[model samples]
Target: MDGPFANRGRRWPNVTVAIIALWTCASPALSQQVSLPPPLASNHATDPPLAEAMQRIEQLEQTVFELQQRQNGGLIEAEAPICFDAPTAELPTHYPIYDSGWTLRPYDAAKTPFELTIGLHNQFRYTGFSRDEATTIDAAGNVNTIPNRNDFDVNRGRLVFSGYALDKDLGFYANIDYSTVASSSIQPLLGWISFRHNDALTLYMGLGKVPGTWEWQQTSRYTMGADRTLATTFFRPSITAGMWGIGKLGDSLSYTVFVGNGLNTLTLRSSDLDTNFVYSALAWWEPLGEFGVGFSDQEHHDNLAIRVGHGLTQTKNDSTSTDQSGAEQTVVRLSDGTRLVEPNALAPGVTVNAFDVWLYTAHLGLKKQGYSFSSEVFMRWLRNIEGTGGTSLESLLDNGFYIQGGAFVIPKKLELFVRGSAVTGDFGTGSEVAAGLNWHLFDKRSARFTLDVTDIRDSPAEQSRTGYVAGESGTLLRAQLWTFF
Candidate 1:
């Protein structure tokens, strides 16, 4: 076991030596020079000496204070600099900026002056027709009968690619269809390039849809029903190579003009120099605000919106005849059997002349909350229509009209729609009614399923012994799936 003095020597050695150095010093200057010895062991006989040492230490306390004061300012500074090296780290390489549901963008998209994005739209449809039977009486009191037949087929399959380039100043769209009932091959739908000068003006050129009425210009993918109304189908030009200009005059006004190959012709250049050219123009105005394209009531506007529009298309056809007949004759005829011209019956050489056709259209649209409604009327006139013997055709006029509307029953998820169309002309009078329900599975009309039923009635003059129907009345049912990505 260690004694108390040995414990003190271990625990308080530095303190005891510091006290002894101060006590043995005689003057303030000598106190700085004094050296302290290590602590010593103690015994009972040495208690008197330890007591003397403690008394001497008490007396030298004042001297130790003076010695500290006499020394230079007591300050210590680091002899060298210190530094720290942290571990190296890397930053993320990829970053995203904008996501507008229809476009892809990069981290620096705002700064980028040019970009291109790819997209696709697809629709698969099945249509079924119901048979009908009808009886007709002729002028001689003869009883004639006609019968309709049922038919079903895939209607459309389209793939599209669209994007903006050159800092969005230039835009491009292209599409092709794989479903063809008349021909077993693919078909080109639309391919166009546009140059946008500003928000108010844009120029387009290529094989694309013609600019006519709202129903004609609106994309089929976004229509409320499974298909467009029969009035629009009969009057609207399908596709053509053309140059079109579209622009906004203000927040509430817009206009469009197009000059192209005549009526649904897709030829880049006409083989016949005398072929006709088609010209179309349209102007629209909004009273309460902008009424957008498409028939669905997806916007649910807070205020009532109204749009009114007018459009016109004019064309002149010129065809040459090589017939050797020495009498006036009709060498060219429209698909509807309208004679192009009455040639000089007495002349023995080729003859050529031009005829004119004019189309006029007016439309209106209204929308509020989850309800949308629209209507359009069309009139067509053919000039200089003559029979083979130069006999003038009577009342070479045609007219068509349609009204359509839709309401979202479940906000954006479910919708109900109805449409009716009527046409009157030399080919006879025909009418149709269509009703449908649209179930939006994803984003509005971007992904949807639809069911539609349509009924048609026609006069005897409109009956054709063609592909499907041979009667004056019929019904059709359709189901469709549409999507975009």
Candidate 2:
């Protein structure tokens, strides 16, 4: 019994010590030691939070990249998928109605169907004559001659306006000249309105150029020389009031048909004596292609073209005496107011019946690189030259031909050319040879300088009819400065 008590006492002391140690470990104020486990290996599947965070960062990075691309002009890779569904705004349609190369145009031309363009054309010329005076002796021993003077003058000063109105289908043009001519102070060169159905068909009405020879149809501003050929000046009527139809047949062919008042007449009202009318038709086929508008001899195309055409007119004469001005009335007059022939030439107070006029023309042109060539032949016939109720007279016949060629010595800047022309008619025969150089200061040929020398040979009868004395044949030196704006 004494041994059991002693063991219990010792066990009690050990228990007390163990309890103290446990208390110390459990006390809040006592510093405690903690052990951490080794870090788990990095793995996306194992760490869902980490993997989601990385995906969010990637999405943010892509957004920044797209925003940057859009800020820099909306440039995006073609293969990239589209990110937006918004529709793009459409732009308004715009069309050009006129050539942009024109020097002047309305400010609103590009935005509207209505447009207006203004242009100016001027030609300054100096002419020197070799023979200042000519003399002629008649059968009655009467000597007739006039002094010919050299001239430095303005050949042409014109204003041009053109455009489309209402729509492109309706086009119009007006060309006015302030220069004086034989019988007029102010001239209306062309004033017309056109209804264009298409390139294949169009109709024109007003005062305009007649559908005559190609040379006659060419604009004065574009002629190769300072003056038109003698054939054109003598034969072609300057202008007419008319209705015309022009159409293109396929790509290389064209046609023109017109009905007009008598040639070169400005009267808008019917006159008792001037009841005659003119009708014309022309057709041209260009085996290679169409030629350009101007005759520059500077090779504007790269192909060859040929044109043939025929024209006819019917006219009547009523006046046979002097007018209120005491000047004799004539059917045909030269540019210098010289009478060539009239019904009165046969006899005083003689009136002719209706006469038929016919004209035929053929032309050939070649343009290749810097080389150019052109030639034309023309023939005219006048039937029924006798007076009314009188015996028949011989029909009048006239013929003319011209050949020209040139090469651009410096491409478009300079050109040298030579031309020869001849005309034969009931009056007589005349020939001319000319050589010239053209200096194109502006590439568009809007500004040019030309110098030429011409030698003329004419029969005495021809000179007489042209108001020159019988023995008028010599050289002419001409210089011209021309500009178009």
Candidate 3:
């Protein structure tokens, strides 16, 4: 028993089908002229109307099939049979859409005034740190010290909120960090508002990272090791409130320029910021295409990829209004880990209150298959020392370099690396040797377990990330579970 919509292809002619198609496209009213039968199941086999409608549907299908055949592999969709349990309620005009990736976004384009995307990152760690003597003497005869640690903690946990409003090209970002080092402290890590003029330019202002070195710019979640190299910690600038210009010249060339308050002005009031400004910039070219935003050959590039970059920072530092004990913001320190602001730091009876600083950096990176290599060199010059009391001073020069390479012994699953760095300056010298491994859990960099062992001698860098205490000789062991949600 054939229904009204059964196949009856040979009854329809080509010319008649063309005319009907044209009439349907003329307007909505004309398009609905050919009515389709409804409310009849195929089991209504004895109904005359059902049989007629079935014949009309078969003719339509043949016409559509002929049109589709004229194109190569193109599809013309036909009416679909509704599911038996499908909901009959119509969709609302404005409904919230949910999306998830590294971040979770929930908003509606029609009803919401703005968009909001939330992201989270957690790094849990087991740090086993030991130092030789746990104390050392600085160039100025001041004793520096650090405590040994064997601890389990959430080293860094971050919550981020960001999205666009008013204009699609205008955006805002905020990152809150819960740091467990020193003491459990919650702080606002980054906050910025940006306007993108086009693909080539974006301008932002607020508190964010000042453009520094290539490794310093890489997202913390993607470092080649559990932390950055010691040399980077020794010379890199600190986060500050500032404005920046970030842009891409083309697919391979990119740059960032920033002007901000003195380095590590996090604890400083606006009144404490002097008229002088800290300025820095970096630009890199990936001649062989994207070298990736982070270290490692995680993507396993089949061809050679290379990137070279140069950066410079210039500033006049005045210690008059700064807190002498802000450990993270003490950007200019003697190689022996003596703060430049300390009285009699360079000579007896002389105190350094102000100084001029200029830093230059160059770096290169290469990646291919399951291997990668990267290195950077730095040069620093300090002059124009201003102090209380008559003082005779000479220019201070510091230089250092770090080289690191890695290979994926098991492709994306397991990787191992070795790194070495040193610092040479007017007061003293420091060096570090380290080896590390990353086990990408489930082959995802977004979730990985990292392990690293490092030996240090008179380390010039002092940062909590690597648990490097200034002016100390020590060995460190770290194991971390890093994940992004």
- The parts of candidate 3 lying over 4 Å away from their true place are 1-113, 182-184, 319-329, 390-392
lDDT of each: 0.62, 0.59, 0.75
TM-score of each: 0.67, 0.68, 0.78
Ranking by TM-score: 3, 2, 1
Following a full C-alpha superposition, what root-mean-square deviation does model 3 have from the true structure? 9.9
Q: What tens-digit string does per-residue lDDT give for candidate 2 at 314-418? A: 444433233211111233432222243433433455444434566677766666666777777777676765554554557777787878877788888888888
Q: Positional deviation of 165 in candidate 3, in angstroms?
A: 1.2
Clashes of each: 2, 0, 6
Model 2 lDDT vs. the true structure?
0.59
TM-score of 2: 0.68
Residue pairs with clashing backbones, model 1: 327-345, 328-345
lDDT of 3 by residue, 380-401 (tens): 8888876665353788999999
Residue 87, model 3: Cα distance from true site in angstroms: 17
Candidate 2 collision pairs: none
What's the lDDT for residue 113 in model 3? 42
Error of 3 at 170 (Å): 0.7
Best by TM-score: 3
